[model samples]
Target: MTSPASSKRPLWIVAATLLLGAAALWGGSRLVWSAQQRDGGVRGMLLETQTGAQHSGALVPLAVLAVAGVAGAVATGGWPRRVLGVVLAVAGLWACWIAVDGVSFSGFPPGAPVWQMFLGRALTLLAGILVLLGGLIATKRAGAMPRLGARYAAPSVKKTARDPDTELWEALSEGEDPTDSA
Candidate 1:
């Protein structure tokens, strides 16, 4: 018999997966396109002198990731979804680190644009938060985990594994014994 909890499990899992897909497909891709525009040619020259846009091609992967992330979310339940979520979360954290790296780690000269720095950092942080949240939400709704200790609980020794004599007696008691010497 299927319990109500069991029946509703698939729906919750699908909803969470789809919501995650929408966020990645819409928001993540937009951020990438903006970064790319700031990277190509004469603007690239201005960006060259700037640490924030130094290697702007990073945006390409961002777009790819957006598509991939959405596709992964839509696939629903299993290790693939879990792994993709972790990857998304990690990528977000890396972006956040990149944004902040110039502040103390880059050792670049002191003329980096204050506004650009903040924007990059803010975007990365936001992505990290969203990815982590998506991963967690999907995991919660999946409910693939086993209940209580039912999986490991000992089987009834009186049934399938019953002693031959006991089985004979039970069969005799039930008047269905075919193996009885009598």
Candidate 2:
């Protein structure tokens, strides 16, 4: 007996989840997290901003993990997908830790919107959560997941009902024509 869920694997959802997480991580890298006044320049004349990647080296790795996970999930199934899931979960946790523990308030000058400085970390945290979600799904449902090109697999050849060499020879010896049996 098979249910709908068992027969169907929503690969698109998994793919979308991974893609969203990756996009968020990449976006986090581009967001300005900290700003500082330029050295040797007029006061407040120029401000240099640091993005998530500049703030912490961990973000890049997390992003890379998400990217790789997408490919792995699409290309693999069963135990391999489960292992990828574990990796994504661990990487997500590490990213969350980096975002929360790596906070520094020293870069922004006075009168700057202090709350805005956390934008990058927020993005990182969100990305981590999304990746973790995708990982958990992959881990728990990997057995049912389908690998790429599974639908295009070749059909197996079927066996003939009777062996011509064995059955035909036997029938001939018995004075029964094999062609008549067919």
Candidate 3:
């Protein structure tokens, strides 16, 4: 028999991982990933900058999915949770790929701030890994997670009112005179 604490551990892990992953994704998206110098024919050299969001549109969606995964873990169980977990995992994998690709296509110029580019990519990668871990665990142990409003679940058994007619027929069948009481 699995203890409640043991079962709840996965839920905690899932919540933490999902929340952290989403944070990373959202943070990375806001960072400047790449910069470039543009030659102005009539003017001067103009610098251009690109961000993680500008690189790929998937970052925000992946982040949102991670957040939603946390909620789904809390609110759902059984097959629905499993499906959500699988989707979260897939989104994380996709984010990882996108992060790598964005960095590869950066085309950093000489003396470019490579740190920013790598940092953003690293954060995105970390987010993906965290979400992936959470998703896998959620899929495997969804039943153990707490459901929404679990504390207020209705009782499994309830007392129903006895019918007078049924009682009378039962007494008669048992050869007891229903009208006899001294």
Candidate 4:
């Protein structure tokens, strides 16, 4: 007995999850790559220092959180969905923190392009907020909503086209006990 509203919730959740995940991935990559190319020659190109030591950024954790958020959205049952919501919210908060830290650089270094830094941080912050909102919505609706898989399940085919005798025989052949009474 799935309602239209109930089915639509999961679809919204899935869409939000995907959008947030993509934003996080893109922003985090930009931040990390921008940092790596900060000291490069001509328009922040990495050609001059391609063999230089690479600096690791917050991209890894951000990616992990995005993956978890998506997994949680796809998971079955209330508890799992709620847990995933919490995870996504936390990830969003973490992304916000990283963005803030990046933007808080005291001195603007010549090597580091200000525009890229701000753009990356801004995207991360926006993505984090969106993800957080999505997570909260998921958490609130999870208890009352049907599992994502169950909601999309195909309806059972009616056997109105079959004769009663044939149906009974088919049922019995499928290991339904004939002597069993309801």
Candidate with best lDDT: 3
* Model 1 misplacement above 4 A: 1-48, 51-53, 56-59, 104-112, 143-182
Top candidate when judged by TM-score against the true structure = 3
User: How far out, in Å, is residue 104 in model 2?
Assistant: 5.2
Error of 3 at 3 (Å): 2.5
Minimal lDDT window, size 10, model 4: 47-56
Superposed model 4: Cα runs more than 4 Å off: 32-56, 148-182
RMSD of each candidate? 10.9, 8.1, 8.2, 6.7
Return the TM-score for each candidate structure.
0.45, 0.70, 0.78, 0.62
Per-residue alpha-carbon lDDT of model 2 for 52-150, expressed as tens digits? 788887787788778888889889988989999888888777777766775786756755545666777787888888888888888888877778877
Tens-place lDDT per residue, model 4, 1-182, is 77878766764775466476556655555553233334455555552221001223555566666665666676655788888777777766766665565345545444656565566667766766766776676677776655657845654774452777887785675678756778
Candidate 3 per-residue C-alpha lDDT over 1-182 given as tens digits, one digit per residue, 9 for 90 to 100: 88878878899999999999999998889887788889988887876778889988889988998998988999988899999999989988887887777356546776666888888889999999999999999999887777778766654654343898877776775578999986
Q: Candidate 3 regions off by >4 Å?
A: 105-107, 154-182
How much does candidate 2 score in TM-score? Answer: 0.70
Give the TM-score (vs. native) of candidate 1: 0.45
Q: Which prediction has more favorable lDDT, 1 or 3?
A: 3
